[model samples]
Target chain A: TQLLEQSPQFLSIQEGENLTVYCNSSSVFSSLQWYRQEPGEGPVLLVTVVTGGEVKKLKRLTFQFGDARKDSSLHITAAQTGDTGLYLCAGGRGKIIFGKGTRLHILP
Target chain B: GAGVSQSPSNKVTEKGKDVELRCDPISGHTALYWYRQSLGQGLEFLIYFQGNSAPDKSGLPSDRFSAERTGGSVSTLTIQRTQQEDSAVYLCASSPRGGGLTITEAFFGQGTRLTVV
Candidate 1:
């Protein structure tokens, strides 16, 4: 079984604080995807990185795929309260094996 | 466009009872998947369907868990003799096309949360 491990299971930061979440796996994946899920809702896809060492940005959020395609990261700059939620990195076949997840809490 | 949809957003059932979950994929989508997410855990893949038949059912946790798709659109996941361990949010997703283990942009439904007593 392929497993993805995410660090900092829970994070609480003040508005304007910056943070980064990590997702690592021992298996290679065809692509990696980032998703943000709010309470009581299904996960919403944020971005997908297919090429190794690729990086994509969405407004204040930046996502990067590892050179080996076995790890990924999400960086948020000057986070806002609205950014609070669970951040998950899915890898492997891109069919998606999710990590334990990082639940972000941005305080105003 | 209409997103994927599921019925019985929340279900509370007794142990040893049976429950069926429904999923309606996006129009024209040829691939559908089923997943389970226990509270505070990541999604656990349950099954994969391409068109009307399941090409991958290895993810099913046990023989009690089975799924089928008909007319290549609507799919049903049936759990027999439900147990407390079966309690979780059941998520359904569909990609525009079958990626065959490759990841594609999959649209997800609201998911059905099942609670076993």
Candidate 2:
């Protein structure tokens, strides 16, 4: 069985602070995706990274896929209150597998 | 539908009863997936279906849980003899295609919140 392990399961930081969460796995994936989920709603896709050592940016967010395709990271710069939510990383081989997620709380 | 659609946004069921959850994938999408999520947790994959091939049921928790996708468009998840532990938000997602060397973006539904009392 393949499992994705996420770090800093819970994080709370003041507004304007920078934070980074990580997702790691022993199994290599063909693609990795990041998602943000607010309360009472399903996760919304943030970005998908398919190449090793690839980086994708969406506004204040930066997502990186490791060269080995076994790990990924999500870094938020100057996080705002709107960034508070659950950040999830999903790795796909023949099937998609999700990390437990990091719950971020950005204080206003 | 413009996006993945799930029925009965909320369900409160008694223990030992059965429940059926429905999902309507986006038109022309050949990949459908079902997942269960507990409070503030990551999605627990339940099942996956791609095109006309057999579904990947490896993720189903037990025999009590079963799902079927009809005509490669809509899917249904049935849980028999429901237990309290089964309470969670059941999420459905769809993609243009999946299950090979490539994967596409998945569109998700709002999910159906199940409460077993």
Specify the highest-lDDT model's number: 2
- In model 2, residue pairs whose N, Cα or C atoms come closer than 3 Å (at least 3 residues apart or on different chains), thus clashing, are none
C-alpha lDDT score of every prediction, in listed order: 0.89, 0.90
Docking class of 1: medium
In candidate 1, which residue ranges exceed 4 Å CA deviation? B100-102
Candidate 2 residue runs with Cα over 4 Å from true position? none
Return the TM-score for each candidate structure.
0.95, 0.97
Collision pairs in model 1: A94-B103
lDDT of 1 at B34: 94
True lDDT of residue A62, candidate 1: 96
